[model samples]
Target: MTRHILIGLIALLPVQAAAGTIGKSEQVQACVLRQIDAAAPVADCVNEAQTECLDLVMKAPMASVACFRDARDTWNGYIGDRMAHISATAPTELAGVAGIEVKYDLLQNLMQCDRMIDLTLLREDPSEATEAQKARCEATATALAYVKLLLQSRNLN
Candidate 1:
């Protein structure tokens, strides 16, 4: 899992450098789309989109969460479609194993992010910003959760 995270973080480095001078959503969208051709990890692609989106609206927590909405939605789409895809493609036993693994990933992702949000809310004066932060964190958790399933499915091919 740590290796997966490291690879994902490293994969984003070049995209991040290239995007440093890009300030428009159009440009960011283009760069993210180009990641497939570049053969970057999908986690990197999703993280770049969310990070850049958040950076664009860092001053407003709610707006930052709004920026994350697209990434969150995209990840949700991936998660939503993946199980059926796996079931249809893999041998039944492999599909069942992958299902269990993906479920574990999903649980770990949400629980860890929830832990963070809970910690934030534990502060004496939690506010709207705290809620917004929670939303963004959930977005990020969802964004990162699907990479393992994605890689696993690809190997099934």
Candidate 2:
């Protein structure tokens, strides 16, 4: 009985570390950033946003949920501004260029990141989010990475 209890306690330790206290904020942030950075390339935007949102929750487990809620809204505005510029210019600048399709594809991918952010980050609550939602957020981050890479290739970033 004593050994069984010890084993049970051991099993709970990782969970406690992951979702327990604000003192664990740095650990939580590192874990979340790893998750976001490791996401598969070109994954869905919502998945990326969800992963980030949930990670923020894990980072500040005891902080008010409203902060995360507000974060998404604020982040969406930033992403929206960047996306708006691409949307306004892509149709014109992307025209008749060599490899235009690739450029357009990358542009669309970035725009999808914005939409996914809206659906996952802005609209959802991290505390109650499902695995699927988190997956969408991870996807968004992945797509963002790819877009960044593309932009850098063109000296845009």
Candidate 3:
């Protein structure tokens, strides 16, 4: 009887993990699209677009990290290439606009959190993370929450 119960529990693990990941992915995508629509100016638009792309990277299921990483690298590369072209061709008035730095350090930190989530998903072992990793992940999550709030505030104006 104990053996049968253990087998059933083990079988349920994959389903639970998949369900949690899918919910998170959907949430990330929804938040991203909303941000894109709220953004103003070309720079803001691109930054928001990149954020959306990163959200996809971070929210992808752990079972699919390789695919997610590939897609993200390609997407970020394309954005970089396009920005280079814009830099070469843009009018002087618009040139400064292109270089406007978005909050990238914060975004990268958030992506790291997403990567940690991917690891957790695959391991089914959230407790495996070191204390430092946990603190960094929590900080990233808090930053993202604040950024989302700031974006929403812009919509009000």
Candidate 4:
């Protein structure tokens, strides 16, 4: 679980870095405020997205799988709720591109979380685990690629 948290946190490092340099759009901020006001578990998602949890997974691979499984459940819930909100409230036009981008990013993260769970459950031996990890990594890579395409479409319009 801790390892999963670490994995997520590690993934978020770039986001955290970019967050400070770029100002978020009003639409995105409004979405966040709504989530917070609704007391969604999204805040816990951010808290776990820090780098401090990575060592636990590195030290104990098998134990880490269990933790990853638990973490997946929490992440699944957060992503589901956020996706629902975004689907309902997200803007579809160019001026709302930032909000749409935020939704795309969240969708990518949701795919990553799904892959983490699949990798953990499919682990049998080191070789098999490696294969599973490769597959899961590919899934996330595909999601990111798609997100890039979506953003490009948004910008092209």
Candidate 5:
């Protein structure tokens, strides 16, 4: 009887977790949309979206893995669209800087998501993740720093 009850409880765990995740994802999505609507410029919108998205991903419960993946993909797509616009509309010299800055911001946000995912995954299964996860996280951080440097260089010139 005890074994049966244990199995039953275990079976319900994932569903309960998923429900909680969905609720959190909905909240994050609303926040992202609100920030996007309030932003005055393309850069500001992207930045706000990225920040909110990262916050959501980092804070979401472990059951929200799928939600995190979806959020990352959505944010990446948005950034791609904004990059195209920046390329065509921004001033010639500043266009590259703007694009890099935007990419950096997006990537930095992604790294945060990755870190959260890694930490969550580790909590669930510590021995299974590849070393590459850490490497990717570090590389993204470095690249983001370089992007900042490029923006600063452009400003100084």
Candidate 6:
């Protein structure tokens, strides 16, 4: 029994680290930049914070929604930085940046409309969770859009 307890405690060490990871913008930047330096795909970093938040919350829905929101904001920041770099270095890419911004807005709007119908209409008792779910949908969509932009930025270099 003591051995089992000891193993369980040891397994949770990473969980403790993950708990402190979410909402730290600097951490997200470092994770992405490290992957870029290593020539690994930075796509994984886009979801790193969300994954850590989900692990910390044990898959609770509301908490998962918050994770998506945090992921959206962090990814957005990274996307903005990348775009600014492209615009500064390659001024000819202004049209490309504008196109990406339009696509991102459309992606978020479409996702919220399509995925949120069930939460808002089909549920027997629609509570505040419905709005929260919609918000999560938007955030998830925005993160997805940002991921695409970040991937494209790789080709600009």
What TM-score do all the candidates reach, one by one?
0.64, 0.27, 0.32, 0.32, 0.37, 0.53
Q: Model 2 Cα RMSD, Å?
A: 19.3
Candidate 5 TM-score over all chains jointly: 0.37
lDDT-wise, the better of 4 and 5 is: 5
On lDDT, the leading prediction is: 1
lDDT for residue 9 in candidate 4, whole number 0-100: 33
lDDT of 3 by residue, 40-131 (tens): 33233223433432354334434234333333333333323333444456554443333332223335555777777777668565542332
Compare candidates 1 and 3 on TM-score and give the better one. 1
Global Cα lDDT for candidate 3: 0.38
Q: List the pairs of residues colliding in candidate 1.
A: none
Predicted structure with the largest TM-score when compared to the true one: 1
Range of the 10 consecutive residues with the lowest summed lDDT in candidate 4: 15-24
Across residues 62-93, which tens digit of lDDT does each residue of candidate 5 receive? 32334443434443333343344444555655
TM-score of candidate 3 on Cα atoms, chains taken together: 0.32
User: Residue by residue across 41-114, what tens digits does model 6's lDDT show?
Assistant: 76566456566554534346666656655555555554455555555555454535544553555455556657
Residue-level lDDT tens digits of model 4 in 1-157: 3334334533532222122211222333344445557887433323233122223345655444443333333333333333334334444443244334544565576677677656766755445344334433433333243233333333232
TM-score for model 6? 0.53
Superposed model 1: Cα runs more than 4 Å off: 1-43
Better structure of 3 and 6 per lDDT: 6
Candidate achieving higher lDDT, 1 or 2: 1
Local error of candidate 6 at 31, Å?
A: 8.4
**Residue 98 alpha-carbon offset, candidate 4, angstroms:** 13
Off by over 4 Å in 4: 1-53, 91-157
